[model samples]
Target: MTISVERAFGLLRIVCEADRPPRFSDIVGISGLPKSTVNRLLATLGDQGLVRFDVEDKCYRPGFGLLSLAAGTWAGLDIRRAAADEMAAMLAELGETVHLAVLDGDEIIYLDKLESAQSIRLFSAVGKRGPVYCTGIGKAILAELDEAQREAIIAGLAPRPYTAHTLTSPETLRAELEAIHRRGCAYDMEEHEEGIRCVAVAIRNFRGEPIAGLSVTSTASRLAGTRMTDEIRPRILAAGRRISAALGHLPTPC
Candidate 1:
């Protein structure tokens, strides 16, 4: 079938902007397209496994095919392979879940995860995607975006509360991202999921754009009262720096 690339991209934008799965009617409403046209497009997307319709909820969400493509892309990235050992060593030393993620549109997609030896660990799948405004790794990568780009991306998001701690307001999230840029690190203070805390730093390539991030996630109870900056932050930053170096980034003293 000959699909219009423009129409396909338009549908993709609608899906990516949604906070949760969107109802068929909602997509039609948002796109201002005819019901028959929308249905045809959705049917095509479904056949490709890029989107799945939930009969019970009557909503459409991203499907496994998108994840499979993402995984294949990640597998081909030399940076991910080069940093795998370092990520594993860091996870082993800290006894916390370590993640390597890259930005996909307005979200962060986990490319790799190193499970900790500890009995208690945050359960995160390798191909899982999370909102940039709520995750440490996402925020770390977002810190590299310029103000205009950041605003454009934030404007496109339909923020929904994932947890009580999730930042739902764009104003507040923008302020937090600004701080992350200045500090060179970002924190997830139970923003995406309750009981989870994380610290992340950006991995930049030779062009100085953040292409990925490295993060450590653990329960809030474990991180509480501990000097994270004095101890954990350095380690996380080191890992990020190492990945950046492997990606051809040369550090200039700040």
Candidate 2:
């Protein structure tokens, strides 16, 4: 039974990896299987909807059943679990705080956090609620929403100033969100806490909907100038892509 299953999967892999749909002879040639066995496996695969016989092209191709299976797997992925390695890597590299958060209406709730090694760190905990307009992860998630949804969310908020650098004007916040979306990242330059700053990116799901955010947090002085641009931004953005990819979000073509 195990050998039978392995042979079936081997045939499936040949079909799936082919640049073009392959004929029965092609499968038999590539798999080195006898004609009778290849025919039987192909017929069984077609019955299961794992492969389909194309009449016009006279070749075998992958079936929609594969998509259904893939969708189910992607949907079941836990965001925190998907992001765990990337978060730990960021903490190790920068010795700064790393955060994972999800949008909760007009705010963001921390899903997980890795505290900085330094004694002076941002005061936050898992499940803590934060303002959407001022924090890095919050703005990253907000920037991924559609214009109508973004506008509605902003209109509903009071937009109070959280610190000296926080932008209270809706017009300015909207402009910043637009910039964040365009650049594929967001920032909190002492906008939330007086000395804290961060860079963040949105994590999307299989449907291309932004479901969560990942960020790197540190003191403003530590994240300034060259370090922010060369090291931090690239790392956080890469982490976002890794997590989003794990959730089955395809990258938009450049």
Candidate 3:
């Protein structure tokens, strides 16, 4: 049976929005499409290697084919290439691990990292995924979301505590997100991982939607004693603003 390309794309959206790989029932619940139709779409997408189902986990996630697509897209307007010098400068100035990330569903996918020269540094690899509820880059991007979208994403989350300081309660996490909006920046207070702290600010496009985030991370010992909020926040915000400007975002009246 021939399927419409648009409908196939619609099914793809459901998997893309999910945090963990979603179960068949979960996809059915969210997409509101008929079960048979959804199953057919999933099968087609899986056959094309655009999605993969884990037999043991009984869940579906994006597949390597999507990475190929991303690589092609990235090759054209590579944010890492465009922003590397600025990130390097920031890393030099701050002597902390600098990261560039973009939102992928309810997660932040780290695209690039600039390690600090400091002897004591927090190690993070490029291509790492962090929860949007706890990481600084995640919060920075989340702050750009409207209430409804934010609530919907949270509704779909299965909060797994990564550390003692992680925000496990939805209510508490929402409140912290609110504070991040108020402050025009976000912080990772050992939420995603113990002993690590990070600060971040959002980069927006011409439409004012957050397209990326820039962050600086270190051990709690370094961030706790330093005046990071006062000193580093402005620098991070400046970098984000510059990137947004490069993406043609003009400041609108708040």
Which candidate gets the maximum TM-score versus the true structure? Answer: 2
lDDT tens readout by residue for model 1, 71-140: 7765565877867988888877888888899899899999998877766646567898888889998888
lDDT of 1 at 101: 90
lDDT of 2 by residue, 1-254 (tens): 69889999999999999998999999999999999999999888888889999999899999778989887886689999999999999999989899999999999999999998787657568999999999999899999998898999999989877899998999999999999998899989999999998999999997899999999988988888878778899889998998999988898798
Error of 2 at 68 (Å): 7.5
Q: Give stretches of model 3 more than 4 Å off.
A: 1-77, 119-123
lDDT ranking of the models: 2, 3, 1
- Worst window of 10 by summed lDDT in candidate 2: 116-125
lDDT of 3 by residue, 108-170 (tens): 899999888776545467888878888899888888788888888889888898898888898
As a TM-score, model 1 comes out at 0.67
Any runs in candidate 1 off by more than 4 Å, and if so which? 1-77, 121-123
lDDT winner, 1 or 2: 2
Best by lDDT: 2
